[model samples]
Target: LEKKIAHQDAIERNAIEGKFGEGKRKYGLGRISARLQTTSETVIALQFLVMNLEKVLRDTFLSFFQIWKALYLFVNRKKYTLIIEK
Candidate 1:
C-alpha cells in the first residue's frame, strides 16, 4: 500500500510538471490552427492550466483536512467539561 501510494504520487507530480512545462509547445499549434480557423475549437489551454493547479489543490484538501478530521475525532471523541477555579 505504501509503495503504491508513493508511486501514484510520483506519477502525479511528473504529469503535472510535463503539462506545465510543454503546455505552450502543444498550444502553439492550437493557436495557429485557431488563427487559420481550421475548426471551431477554442483551444482550452486555460482549462488545462486550471486542471493542473486543481490537482495540487485537491491533494492538499484531501491530505490535510482528512487527516485533521480523523485526528480531531480521535482526540475529542469523549469530551469532558471541567470547572476552572483560580
Candidate 2:
C-alpha cells in the first residue's frame, strides 16, 4: 500500500512539473518580471489560470467533435437506408 501511494505521488508530482515546464516554455513564465513577492505570485497564478483555461477549451472542442462525428454517422446511416428502400 505504501509503495502504491508513493508511486501515485510521484505521478502527481511529475504532472505538476510538466505543467510548470510547459508554462515556462510557452508563456514566458520561466522568468517572472515582478520585483515584489506578491506580484510574482500573482503572475504565476495567472499563468496557470491561462493554461487551465486553454486545456478546458481544447477538451471542449474534442468532445464536441466526437459528438458531431457520432451524429453525422447516425444521420448518414438513416439516409443510406432510405436510399436502399427507394
Candidate 3:
C-alpha cells in the first residue's frame, strides 16, 4: 500500500511538471520579463491560463473536424450508391 501511494504521488508530480514544461515551451513561461514579484506571478498565472484555454480550443476544433469529416463521408457514400443503382 505504501509503495502504491508513493507511485501515485510520483505520477501526479510528473503530470504537473509536464504541464509546466509545456507552458515553458509553448507560451514562453520560462522567459518572464517582469521585474516585480507580483507581476511575475501574474505573468506565470496568465501563461497557464492561456495554455489551458488553447488546449480546450484545440480539442473543440478537432472534434468539429471529425464530425464534419464523418458527415462528408456519409454524403459521398450515399451519392456513390445512387450512381451505382442508376
- Best by lDDT, which number? 2
Residue-level lDDT tens digits of model 1 in 5-86:
9999999999877775665575452343454333423455454666668789999989999999889988987674456899
Q: How well does model 3 score by local distance difference test?
A: 0.91
The clash tally of candidate 1 reads 0
Candidate 2 regions with alpha-carbon error over 4 angstroms:
1-9, 78-86
Candidates ranked by TM-score, best first?
3, 2, 1
Model 1 CA lDDT for position 36:
36
24 in model 2: Cα distance from truth in Å? 0.8
In model 1, what is the error at residue 83, expressed in angstroms? 25
- lDDT at position 58, candidate 3: 100
Q: What's the CA RMSD for each of the models? A: 11.5, 3.4, 2.9
Better of 2 and 3 by lDDT: 2
> Relative to the unseen true structure, what is the Cα RMSD of model 1?
11.5
Please, what are the lDDT tens digits per residue for candidate 2 over residues 38-57? 99999999998998899999
Each model's lDDT: 0.69, 0.92, 0.91
TM-score of each: 0.36, 0.75, 0.82
How would you encode candidate 3's per-residue C-alpha lDDT over 1-86 as one tens digit per residue? Answer: 99999999999999999988988898998889999999999999888888889989999999999999989988888665644453
